[model samples]
Target: MTKKDKYQKVAYYPGCALEGTGHSYNRSTKAVGKALGLDLVEVENWNCCGAMEVKNVDPKLQTYLSSRVMSTAANEMDMDVVMAPCNGCYHNLKKAEYDLKHDPESVEVVSKLSQKAGHKTYEAGQVETIHALDWIKDTVGEEGLKERVKNSLNGIKVANYYGCMYTRPRHIFPEKDQGPGSESTSKPHFMDDLLAAAGAENVEFPLKTACCGGAHTLSDSDTSTKLVLNILKAAKLAGADVIATECPTCHSGLEMHQIRAEKVLGETVDIKILYFTQLLGVALGLKPRKVGVHENVSDSRGFLKERGLA
Candidate 1:
């Protein structure tokens, strides 16, 4: 089948970061998907879910707001699976769907809220929530990904970082979903597989799924420093040359604030962090800047140069 026929109607949810702070994420995901033969159809009228803070302040209100966004994909656009590239949006949308489906009171409250926002009705299973990483693993396949690897990540060790939100709330994630073959959440090892396919050595990181403190870095700086430091330390201990992650939040938290983390943690370690999509783009024979490798705080250019890819 042709590429258009393969993914005739895939919904791409850019979320808040994809447009602004996480703009690189949308670009990289779109580029990688296109290179690997998946035409990503982004949702046109999508909005933000306000991440954890909104849900924490008022669960009911947050659910209503999130439901409206999901309803847009379901009722208005008629999408089967809404591929959320951002972890925050993925979790928020998944949570709202679950609450509306399982709890009648929540459903009724959110229904009215949806109407207030000019929406018809929010239904359960309207749009199946999924992460881009999961979709890439399934549609692209290991062998297909292998074929796209033009340049191997030789002599470079990678540490896979999966922050919070990407994998939580047991309800949205199926038991089998956690497996390599399922479409449940963002699998860091999926990136590892792609890296390995490109002939790179993926360090078996013990703290691959560890939290990177996210926005908490702003409020609880000390605790956040420790969290970021530990993950970096884990990567260093495992002999990783660079840390790789899919979430932009994790990338910002760890990479953008490496200097601060070093001062707080009392050690200066040489490490760089890159988004998993950027790495995938490199493997797909795309230029580094096109995939957002330049946006990172660490000089990832050197990593690419050493490998003769720059």
Candidate 2:
């Protein structure tokens, strides 16, 4: 079937971060889906994707963790597609899928673990994993977004920040030539295209796939702060009022470090950080609370209110 038809309903996997600091992303994602007449069936009995410390410590262990999540979706839920909002989760699941298919060691480890844990082992090609960006972009094209926009973000200048992830070493991403979407490794523009469809002007920001240093946030505070500050400063210099992010870690890192940089380094960059889903929700005329904009670490209600969005 067509992507517009197939992706209308899929397994939604909101990783660990979404329930905590990235709650705004969770809320806004569901809100935008509802506004657009789409359906999402949450995955059952999900687990972490091992994008955190587990991966560094044990690579196979990380692959196992990600495999379990996909296992529940495919084996139990009988799903053909799994949608992840966080980039880390998306990247991890894709990595696990790739590993299980190609690497005999990963398959052997996961199989042994699944047998011991009394759960079905996840086999590759059973389900297709996609980012939330892919879910909406494939199902709802730019024209669909433009048709659904209730409040035009005509005056907003946005700098789209796609974090440095999804660089699947196995080249496991689906073929981009099938009219699904373009998966440009060098410069991904799904976020930019979505915002532009909502009437926002995307700035010429050079940092598309830059690292947000989220993995080093706790382990190295100064380094994380410096990395975040560079992104904030560059967005400001590009005349962007907001830096739109898709990943929860990247979103929270931008929000938290934006505050830390000001208090610690005394470098205050006056730019609002928002999830792209939150921006899309507002453009779709959903209330601020509906999109959890007020729940963001850095408040943008006043800023959006000034522009008649709130």
Candidate 3:
């Protein structure tokens, strides 16, 4: 079938962050999906996908954690594809799929864990894992997005930030870099393409895939603050009024550090941080409150209002 047919309806895995700090992203993603006429079935009784923290304790354990989520989607839900909005969830699920296929040790651990956990072992190739970006870009495409735009974001400047988890170590994401119409890990443009379709001007953002140090944001606050400040300052220097984020960790990190930098280092960067889905929702003529824009730490309602978006 075509890309759109394949991804029109898939299992949605919002993970833990979505219910908490990333609620805005969760709200916007579902709102945008509804507006686009796409179907999203939430994986039933879903658990955490090990994210970046759990893996540090044990790689195989992380594999098993992710395997459980995919197992539920494939075995119980009878779904062929699982779409995760969180980059960490997407990466971990993809990594579990890769490990189960290539590494015998991972297979052994997951098998044992499944038995103990009273669930079916998630074998390799049982289900395909995709990111929210893939779900939108592959299904809707830029042309589709353009046709749906009601309140065009004309003159709005955006700096699309994909963060590190979405496109690092390249091997895990095999579908990317497969030529035209495919996402490039080195220079991902799915967000850029979607935002552009909404009539937003994408600035020349070099740190689109930069690390916000989300992994060590708490352990190493100074480093994460520095890294986040760099990204914010870079966007401002590039003439961007907003930084469009796809991942929750990166979005929260940037917003938290933006305040920290000003309070601690006396360095202020005046750029609003917003979820990409929130931007798309507004462009689709949905009210800012509908997408939970008010939930974001970096208030952008005034900024959006000035541009006639709110």
Q: Estimate each model's TM-score.
A: 0.91, 0.97, 0.99
Candidate 2, 1-310: lDDT as tens digits: 9988989999999999999999999999999999999999998878889986899999899999999998998899899999999989998898888889899999999999999999999999998999998899999979999999999999999999988775434276654434436767666788888999999999999877778789998789889999999999999999999999999999999888888999999999999999999999999999889999989999899999998898
Q: Which scores higher on TM-score, 1 or 3?
A: 3
lDDT of 1 by residue, 251-296 (tens): 7788645778666666677888887788888878899888877766
Q: Please list the C-alpha lDDT of all candidates, in the order they appear.
A: 0.76, 0.90, 0.95
Q: In model 1, how large is the Cα lDDT of residue 198?
A: 69
How well is each residue in 1-310 modelled by candidate 3, as lDDT tens digits?
8868989999999999999999999999999999999999999999999988789999899999999999999999999999999999999999999999999999999999999999999999999999998899999889999999999989999999999989987999888899988889999999999999999999999999999999998899999999999999999999999999999999999999999999999999999999999999999999999999999999999988999988
lDDT of 3 at 296: 99
Backbone clashes per model, in order?
Answer: 0, 0, 0
User: What is the descending lDDT order?
Assistant: 3, 2, 1
